[model samples]
Target: MLQIDLWKRVLIWALVLCGLALAMPNLFYSRVETHNDAVKAIAASGGVASPDQTAEAAEWPSFLPSGLVNLGLDLRGGAHLLAEVQVSDVYADRMDGLWPEVRDTLRAERATIGTIRRVDSAPDELRVQVGEPAQIAQAVALVRDLARPIVSLTGVGASDIDVSAEGADVVVRLSEAEKQATDTRTMQQSLEIIRRRVDEVGTREPTIQRQGEDRVLIQVPGIGSADELKELIGTTARLTFQPVVGRTTDGSADPGARNLLLPSLDNPGEYYIIEDRTVVSGEELTDAQPAFDQNGRPAVNFRFNPAGARKFGTYTAENIGSPFAIVLDSEVISAPVIQSHIAGGSGIITGNFDVEESTQLAVLLRAGALPAKMTFLEERTIGPELGADSIAAGKIACIVAFSAVLIFMALSYGFFGMVANLALIINVGLIFGLLSLIGATLTLPGIAGIVLTIGMAVDANVLVYERIREELKTSKGPARAIELGYERALSAILDANVTTFIIATILFIMGSGPVRGFAVTLALGILTSVFTSIYLTRLFIVMWFERRRPKTIEV
Candidate 1:
């Protein structure tokens, strides 16, 4: 009556062994983590590992599972920042770029519109005043023709730009559909750039996610402070090459409508008036690195893509003796005269830069520019000492709960209680094993979930033991009593755990951060508890029954 099939027996033992094996790595977490990092470094470096790294990797066997549960920001201490992207900034930039196009289109219809002049308006609005009011309709129609349909699922057939006329002035702005599309793309690009910048520092698992339409939440574990992280991502890094018109000491110089007056990076009070039209943009850069100039000064070397190279080469060849300004975020970094017809798409940017500035500049150039400026709304730093205290407290709570549950089970049903205790222990191991295998982050709340699980795990064993006691009073054989006990308890165990598991699943799907962590451990605990109680405990009981051959015994 208490017999288990060979396949079932083997399966039970296999699962137990695998769980133990997986959980073993957590006991040697530091060693395993070091091994894992070394392996990753070596792989990233194309198998060229340092002697120390090779030694560290060799300390842990290659055959063993090296996965470890990642510690959360709360437990590892990190920087947290919530930034809001200024999506409207991109709108202004887009409008500024459209000026050249709008001017060209209106000039083609110069006979109708008369004189067309750009007027100052809101940052998001593009206003153009025409001398001839009668031709306003023609001007609006021409501007509207430039509008392309928004390329998005929700905004299909909607125009990218909206053109309207108020008397002789034509007003243009990005349509609502285009704004939505631009916001989505901007947020996605911001997230990617932020991730790349953070990853470049080699910080472990960082949580960089979009909070809402314009906000991004960044949490980097093991980071010193929020300021450090902000410094890394806050730079706009907008690099442009413009034809320089003249240099002046006047900060308030009006450099005409088509020119921009930008301050020099090295020289205070010096400004350079440069043409607004860009010869080359940083977006066309394929690679950038920190290197030394011909004079051995720290500088940033850059290589342009083919299209950028062609444009830059042609511009340089045409304006051989004229100075071109290298502008970074509206600051004139340099205005070097074209010495000769420079070709091949390669150039060096030399400023009054030290080694550190050059390196940071290089990193920013390589990561690409943010689509929009970000204003940090919230910033926080978690200290490692606090995390240590939390971990210590969590460990104490777990040990206390575990000891209490084990003692209660032992006192209630004697030998059967001991069997339940063994299963409970294995269940805990299985929970850790599964967590490690899946690389789930464990938080303080997750520790609480495991503690709660320890108390709940004994419920199945109690049900079986009580049922067995009742069957024994009815004069059923010990083996037969035990068999019926498990059979009767199966439905109750499944129903109760399934309902709880469903709740845990819902929590996991809907919840974020710590709540998800709790749900993970809770769900895993439920599964492991069921397996150990039904199969593992029964196996032990069956083995005992066969060995003793007792006619009557206590559960």
Candidate 2:
């Protein structure tokens, strides 16, 4: 009478087989990884496979599951960087953008203010000198009118900029509340841009997270070095098209008002004096691709959105025959003369760039520019050898713990313990299988969690075996004792594992990085262990009991 139904038995075996099959790829980790990469590369290349990729893809069969547990930084080796975003740079950019609006506003009130000119001030401050000192109040009032209400919750109803008269000049600066909002937005944007850039390289399990107020922590598991990562992310790649005022050989040439002198990228010592006001910024770009120019030279082609297209078309049409400077990261890449009206918002950037440079530029353009500059605070390149050592140590610890648990269970509970030990093995396989299915990164702490799980996995079997022994002492038959053992132990097993599962969930939600990795494995181990102990182990016992038809048994 102690028996599992046909459907339940089938389900248990099915789950076990599925778990083992999914976890099989890890046995040949490098081969499967290579095959997966080759497949992905072929897919990315529009299904056109190279000879090497084809050979690599053939290493693994197409019918089998290919998922493998992603190794974490502690297991894989990588780059780590702590970067401090120069948030105040955003304030400078905001002020520079505000100047055009402020100039246009004051020009409309020229009758009273006479004339207005941007004067020297802090990078974060916009100071305008009013020709008519008597009308300074009117100038301040006009500038203040340009201030829009901050859209953030904390800064609701507060103006974005603070305006006041500094002697004869009206001084404008971002308000404290607006600065706080900008800092938050800047950090978020930086994080996103960094993530996109890292993802573009097709690396695995990169950690890009915000630290304190303006710091970002980036841990890339497969990058060569921190310097390499810094290079990939540090370049702002801020592309802008601006009206070129004139070309100059002098680096320190005065570009007059509202103009910038930027060095040409292709020609050393030559500079382009361009309007600081952007005709079209890279933020409006929707697509960028590396392609060959008319002369077969490597170049980048870019297409802008509708609004950007309209503005670009209007600017080019109105300024035909004048040169427009294509600026990247404060340097002029090229100053091409516009012979006629160029519409459609599509253009080419031709410079002294090779194929790799063009491709990298395209990637950066597609990813968008960082909102502010970042200063690297801490940088480290974890070597693969060290990671291998950690992995080896973790493996030894898990094996020792696993063997000890298996031996203890077998010695203490005898034949019943062997069944539980088998279930424990399946439980671990299920954990790895689940991790693979979800593409979870396994850290050293995650391995520790698995080891801890192995020890705890036998608790349910212990309770059931003790109950059976007690029932047998009360003169109950073997079949009846086994049934009562599982039935009575079910509540205790659920209560204990349920509480542990809740704690694991809380840790996952509240923790990050390695802590979250531990939580994930711990939570998964709980589920799998519970299934194996209560269901799989019971099925094994019931099958053995039904076949043997024993009169008496020892737990």
| Best prediction by lDDT | 2
Each model's TM-score, in the order given?
0.83, 0.92
For model 1, the run of ten residues with the poorest summed lDDT: 40-49
Which stretches of model 1 miss by more than 4 angstroms? 51-59, 152-157, 239-367
lDDT per residue, candidate 2, 523-548, as tens digits? 99999988998999899999998889
- Model 1 lDDT at residue 499: 95
Q: How do the residues 148-261 of candidate 1 rate in per-residue lDDT, one tens digit apiece?
A: 888999899899999999988999999999999999999999999999889876677788889978999998887899999999999988899999989999988799999998
Candidate 2 root-mean-square deviation in Å: 2.6
Instruction: Report how far off residue 227 is in candidate 2 (Å).
Output: 0.6
Candidate 2, position 276, lDDT:
72
What is residue 537's positional error in candidate 2, in angstroms? 0.8
Q: Compute the lDDT of residue 265 as modeled in candidate 2.
A: 97
